[model samples]
Target: MYILHRTNARPPLDIKDAEKSDTVHFINSRSKRQRINEKFDAAKSRIERHQKRWTEIGKELPPQINRRHISVISIGGVIGTGLYIGTATALIHAGPVGTLIGYMITGTIVWSVVISIGEIVAFLPNVGGPVGLAGLYVDPALGFALGWNAWYNWTIILPTELSAAAILFNGFFPNKHEDFIRQSNIVAITTMIFFAIVINCFGSRAYGEAEFFFSCFKILTIIALIIAGIAIDLGGGKEGFIGIKNWKTPGPFVEFRASGALGNFLGVWSSMNQAVFAFFGTEVPGVAAGEVQNPARNIPRAINRVWIRITLFYVLAVFVAGLLVPSNNPDLRGSASAGSPAS
Candidate 1:
């Protein structure tokens, strides 16, 4: 029993020795850690104070979209009346070859723009997208300017889209009186606005779902149109194996005002506006990075798909349209009442 007691006994410690013990050291370290944490929190708060109010509020809403949603948004956000109707104007101005060349040039530009936007969005994932990117990395004043500029653009675009839809809706009744067309346009605009409000009110998830559905539909429709145009060219219609007849007859390029290569070059240049218009919304995927899951992975994937969308949707469609119609067609001139040049 005496041996056991001796073995269990601990050595005595002096004041200095006790201060260096594990328990005391742990206590001191814990207090130091607390101070460090407090300083860190203070610095974080100070930094956050400089952030935009929207950036703070944006974080409160968790990401609600996935890779597929982002891809669809990027792919379809800009596929609209511009491609369907505006291409006609391009064809009228620049003939088949000129229009095709203009679109190809614009496609390259669009690809570069989307790539740049995707890189920035993946790195930063800002709420204001390009606007926020400018503020954080470039200059806050630049961001502010871009924000208001974007606001002005969207404000103009919203009403213009509604007006375009109204005009297209009026196209169904070509023989209708002017008053009837005007009234129909009013009704179409109101109905579209109501649907837009309802869809947006359902939140991002609903918007994503709706966009996906429409994107798929548009994809199928464009594909069908292209196939039909090809078939008609290859003797699938009464025209019977049109081949490159239109191209040969009208020649490859049209002059804008002059009668030679200069006119053709000018025609191609003028068509650039419509080509650029066709790609207006291609950057939406970057804009949507804040609302998408795993933006680092998904945004780049979506950006990679931009070229595919441009080639299949815009380039091929333009090529097929050029094949199907002569640039000098009177219908391609388009009257005030003509809603669609293709139609």
Candidate 2:
């Protein structure tokens, strides 16, 4: 142990005094170094304590996902069946322009949230996922609330995705009886749930690989759609030269459950629910920060690509869907067999 002493002295005026001043300077720098070392040790201890707690509980998440896996997952998370099927309902409730506006607003919100989260994750990737982070940085109560809120959200979303898959499956057997359709839906949902459980049980590496494949597939699908949309807009479809005709004819907005400007406002407001659902998992990369290889480097890189994904996959997709399909098309409200504005 060492005692730090403070000295008050006049400026050095001669060689002998200069030597004393040098000694004092050295002492000050050594003290500063000791303070930094103490802070480093404290921070290291905190991280070790967290790791020990998780290890004791048998829940320590090992780093298994690489940069590519994490990046693709974040990009594809936002491009789900909700974006595929739910947007049709948005179009019906609010016209093309209104749906576009709703999606843009939601995208902006997602971007802001991910940017803030990215900075924190780059600094400290695993204070535990978002739940642990909230407890550490904010309040324990807020962390508890977020934990339960996430649980509730996932619970609902799981069933919703399963149901949406079943609906899409039913599209193949259009002429089948209602009873047969119901049975097929049950089978599809059960099969998917079973596969999901099996995949997760295989451990984090397997899960990351699986996500990487699916995310890549989704990315390709969106890219294809973007190209097709451009072609269709440029008079490649049967409806030649179909520029912004939908916008002009439908008048770019809808009146929902009422008449006049208030109704149109309501329409846009209601459409936000669909947009929110579409963008629900945009922060998935942040959630997986703990398991990402070299998270301090990878997490920020993955998050930086979020805006690109949003602009290309989501915003552009909505723009194309609006241009191609009219909001008034009764097919928008028809059975799930009709299959999305884009479809």
Candidate 3:
């Protein structure tokens, strides 16, 4: 141990004083070094403690999902319920041309966003993903902003999923009493929320499993719809020889609130928001960055497929949906809620 002493008395102005001043200077230097060492040790300990806590939490979590599961989820994430139901309204408002243009533009934007997130998160693995990257590479405040926004979005999306499904479940019992429908929605919504919570409790792997299967179903549904739409357009439906009939009659363009090229452009611009809402799930894989088994290998592979995800799955689906239904169809104007244009 080193002893530190403080003195107020001045050294006498003599040759003897020179030695005393040198001794005092050496003592001050030692004290300054000690203080620096103490601070460094304190900070190191805090980091160790924080890391320990994080490790404990990691231990409690269920088996982390691998690159493959996340990849499948990412591929199918674009097929949200909004695409099926909300596209009807978009068709009515923006018309087929506008909706198709909107999807293309938004697809480019979403592709950029996914690539950015993937690159950043891949370089800094086993961390908070985007939030951690933001703090490390940019300002800590940016991290906080992004983190809170993600939390808020996920919190709201869970309920929205349940509520939308519950309301749509009423189609089967159309003749049921109004009271029965109300009770059924309550029961269904609560059960769905409970099921989701239980999956979360099991861990991220369980959630991944659930989403994986659901995504499979969604992917199949989208594929089937595209096929069905093509068949329908090619006279496979009860209505014979309906090939591009809607497009020709509706003129492939409609002047929105204002009539002309500007209105057509505005229609596409306005539909961009609808496209964005459907695409919100495209970044879901970013949330699981910390637990990913192979960030370097998996992250880039999944991200590189952005073109396939957006163009093949989303852009194609929107194009098919546009071709299947005409803009003037009353169903597109909201008489048929939760029903697709083909229905």
Candidate 4:
């Protein structure tokens, strides 16, 4: 509990008697500042009380977790359900060039944020992360505001992620009974959530081991996709050589908003939100800086590598997708199936 001091009540100073009452004027001015400070402290303490429960969750999280775990999480967490299929939407609205332009711009922005936060987290690698930093270095109001925003945002994201995983899985068996899929979805989400909680309960070392293997799997999967995409583009499959043919037929750029070159640029800009979604989790390292082994070494390293990895895995993958699939494809418009773009 924070103790707030209240100053004694005083009357307002009159300018007419200013020369005669310097002490009274000074006392009134100082008391006014103290009252303002007391009010601010009260608000700050109230916010911190609400935030205390969230910080307690980190108390059980051990600090032995190393660079490998944090690094992979930083890279892997960003690759979400959006990357798996929603990118198809971007391709449709914006053609290949537009999509590329949007991703590059968004990627640069993400990179800037990652680096800026990395520098701060490296300097003060505390457990509370952005939540703590906002109050400590910046204003408490900013911290309180951002903390609630993040809490609200992430709370919504969790269930959506579960449903998304189920949806992507259901895409595999298009002929399966909907009732069975619905039942299985309930089972899958429950099981996954349970396992995630169990892993987290085991503390950071357990998490490090688990995430290490998962990251390896994710990296390998992306590599495989890129390779397969290239193969498909170069006439690897029985479909014959694609070789930028789709790009030429539909034309590289699509006019989206108004007209001329400006519309085309806007078309590219339109996918910025989707690109932002795709590049969301690149800052896991900064968030988990307190638990990581070496803040200075690991955080900066992750920041540097994350951008390149994202470009290679995401940007290049989108490029390959554009080359292999046409922007005007009906699947992008949801005419093909309701489940997933891949399906």
Candidate 5:
């Protein structure tokens, strides 16, 4: 016999009795269907919650840059030491015409690559730049390699820039001792690096401002150089416009060994390599897409201008240098020994 407990609440029923009982039973036939439905509903809700969380996790980051800054910064980053120094070597290897042709070819290739990058960057501007794109469009491994390689390359470039700055300063102050110059250069570079880090730490606004001014200065400098070069070529002070006859006289292609077509081809290839290196930083603008203010507007504008800028700055500069100093000139041939005026 089962004794029923007397209380305000109803007493629990035995499993067999509850199944057979019809009074307010939660596990009855209809209740069983409700329980299954409830379970299904709960499982569906949990799956939805998980999916929502994943969507949040996978959301893209906001852009940090503006349009103007990106356009100018890209120009600044690309028109550095490579264009200034490396072009001379290319001009030496392949005469003016050969160098020009090589630049045209390489410039086209680089322009195509930049345009492709622009399309992707405009769609999804992000900080990781090309590496991020590669990961998304290509593979993770490739992205990792490209990212680290780029980081390493920039790391090495910093020290080299510092060294170059020191050399330039020493030229201005010839009286400075070698050891003193070296130490001073290290101190200066360290200070600049520290300041840059501080500015960057503040945020993107500061960086954008700094880049804007720096790029402006670079642009002005280039403009001045172009003007000065044009004046010099036209015989501004000493000589009068030296016309295009020099190009015709030398007949553009200069063979190192004078071995004919094959030799000339090899020489041109060597020069092409140098020219390609000179244009290495042309894609730096795309890297700035994340920071650009109006990426869609400025990125395409910047990318579109790359070929023109490269041709004008690099190819035109080389052409001028060739005109001012013939390819056969000792300076052009890079044969100036130690203490040589060209050196």
Candidate 6:
């Protein structure tokens, strides 16, 4: 029997009729493919244009750093009050050898982390610094977390540094009224902050100049301290200098518990934590990677030097301090209620 299909777009097709309509379906599929191709081509062209524009803009921007400034800034960034004032306590806690080992371990770890960061900064140096680096190499979330945390840390640190400077000043002027000291410190810190902002805002050269002077001061102070300490130890000021007997006498390693090696390990770990805190600012140079000149060259140089610099300033400082004043001495620990050990 023959079956007839009536039209209204041929009604519903039976199996045989559907097979005959495959040509129509093929035409529709080809048309959809053509539309997709057009959309992809347009998108590709748009992206290429955007990329070219940005490349041109990047080339036009002025270089933000020079070698001299970057070198000095890196040094200044790492050398701060922590090395000067905080080393004594770590010495007392860890003893000379333990303190040295603790700083070396932490410093090495910190330098390793910084070197990984440096690899990225060398490729894309910009004012945004590590925040920008994080966003590029990692993710937006990580970048945001690091950026804000770093900013907050610096904000807190500025005031703390100012407070320390004030206390140091008061040491030289013992009879000054508290109110006067406070006001004077406020002025001095405010002036320093203002100058720093101004210099940074002007250009890298100005910032570099400021950093050079800052580093020079720190270097001079350290040298003088080392020289004087040696002189005092050698009996320079009339009382014949006492040698390294303090380390051997009070003992280089102190036993916190009357137990086993595990107890000693825990004790040393606790002492290491304090030493790590004192050496924490060594990462400042890593943060300055973006502002560093010839980052591929200078940055790696700076990162390579961090371990030695930290070891010398922090570990050596503790060693010298221990030599001058034995760790076990009650006076070195001071009283919990009292101010810092240096005071």
Task: State in Å the error of residue 20, model 2.
Answer: 63
**How many Å off is the CA of 103 in candidate 5?**
1.9
Model 1 over residues 208-325: C-alpha lDDT tens digits? 8888988988888888998999999999999789888888878778899887889999999978888987788788888888788888888899888888789999999999898889
lDDT (10s digit) by residue, model 6, range 141-176: 787898899889878877767665655555555455
TM-score on alpha carbons, each prediction: 0.81, 0.81, 0.77, 0.77, 0.70, 0.70
TM-score of candidate 4 against the unseen true structure: 0.77
Whichever of 2 and 3 has more TM-score, that candidate is 2
Alpha carbon deviation, residue 198, candidate 1 (Å):
1.6
Q: State each model's CA lDDT, in order.
A: 0.79, 0.81, 0.73, 0.74, 0.66, 0.62
From the highest lDDT down, the ranking of the candidates is 2, 1, 4, 3, 5, 6
What's the lDDT for candidate 6? 0.62
The Cα RMSD in angstroms, rounded to one decimal, for candidate 5 relative to the true structure is 15.8
Error (Å) of candidate 4 at residue 111 is 0.9
Superposed Cα deviation of residue 198, candidate 4 (Å):
2.6
Runs in model 6 lying further than 4 Å from the true structure: 1-61, 174-201, 237-239, 254-267, 328-343
Best of the candidates, lDDT: 2
For candidate 1, the 10 contiguous residues with the lowest summed lDDT are: 1-10
Clashes of each: 1, 0, 0, 0, 8, 1
The TM-score measured for candidate 2 stands at: 0.81
| Model 2 root-mean-square deviation | 9.8
